[model samples]
Target: MSRVVATTTLWRPTGPEELALVEASGWAAWPPRLPEQPIFYPVLNEDYAIRIARDWNVPASGVGYVTRFEVEADYLARYPVQQAGGRTILELWVPAEDLQEFNQHIVGPIEVVHEFRPQA
Candidate 1:
């Protein structure tokens, strides 16, 4: 089955380091696995992104970034969304090994939507 992805999709609340890689690589992928980061997470909505940026990243790292991009939505159907921590936060978790396939699914370049940096 084909899923028609909207003209745009949302990826969000990225830390500065990760954001740099995404900007450089041209697509978002799962970061290297550590005990802390076991999966690659890409968010699917703005509300969730905002929550992460404001409530999580800013408090934790003092900065967050949201990126917008066009992906082959049909390919996204292969992955399942995981909801945790609370409602309103929905994201896809791509396993580390499967990340290549995930990256392949992205249709084009990624663009930054908003940068959340708290003034010190």
Candidate 2:
């Protein structure tokens, strides 16, 4: 018998410094969420990730990164996709404490799909 696996994509927008740190860490998991952060929000699509990586990260940090990874659809069933700011923006809000577990569900290493460096 054959089986099919369902996968869902997730994206994270990060600053170059953080991206470098993540890459150095051997492409395993994202850094631990900050103390005050209630949820670790991973955007649903590349477009939103790029917007943040450019409009936000570039001006503030001089460079931005967009990471892409897939997780089992069943594993992510508990969380709901949220629309914020507008129709094009959607993301998953995973509680900070559950982040490590979330990372475990990721099928493979995270890939930096896009990089944006501010030109001076």
Candidate 3:
């Protein structure tokens, strides 16, 4: 018999370098955060992710991608959703140390849902 897995959808805004790393993982995991990055944050809404990817990442990198994935709900329960600014700007802050374990809880392959590039 098959069992149902509870999952919560999350979105991440990323640049080409990071996206390449994720692709190298066969879309199964997020690459480890850099030494300066103490936390890995995944947003709770697509709109917020889009804003960051378009307004921030694209300007910085020339290209940005919005990725969507699912994480096992039970594993994610330990981290409370944070409101960065307003009600819609919600995200989960997972410590860099815990990212490996967090990656393991991802329900399936990550997918790029949107891409933003500088207007030429």
lDDT (Cα, tens digit) per residue for candidate 2, span 2-118: 567788989999987767777886887877788988898899978999999999998999888899988889999999999987897999999998988987888778899888887
Best by TM-score: 3
Candidate 1 vs candidate 2, lDDT winner? 2
CA lDDT, every model vs. true structure? 0.71, 0.87, 0.98
- Candidate 3 or 2, higher TM-score: 3
* lDDT rank order: 3, 2, 1
TM-scores of all predicted structures: 0.76, 0.90, 0.98
**Candidate 1: tens digits of C-alpha lDDT, residues 12-82:** 57778777777667565534555676677778788788778777787777787777666676777777778
Candidate 3 C-alpha lDDT tens digits along 1-120: 988999999999999999999999999999999999999999999999999999999999999999999999999999999999989999999999999999999998999999999998
> Which residue window of length 10 is worst by lDDT in model 3?
1-10
Off by over 4 Å in 1: 1-8, 26-35, 85-87
**Candidate 2 lowest-lDDT run of ten:** 16-25
How far does residue 46 in candidate 3 sit from its true spot (Å)?
0.3
User: What are the root-mean-square deviations of the candidates from the true structure over C-alphas?
Assistant: 3.8, 1.9, 0.5
TM-score of 2: 0.90
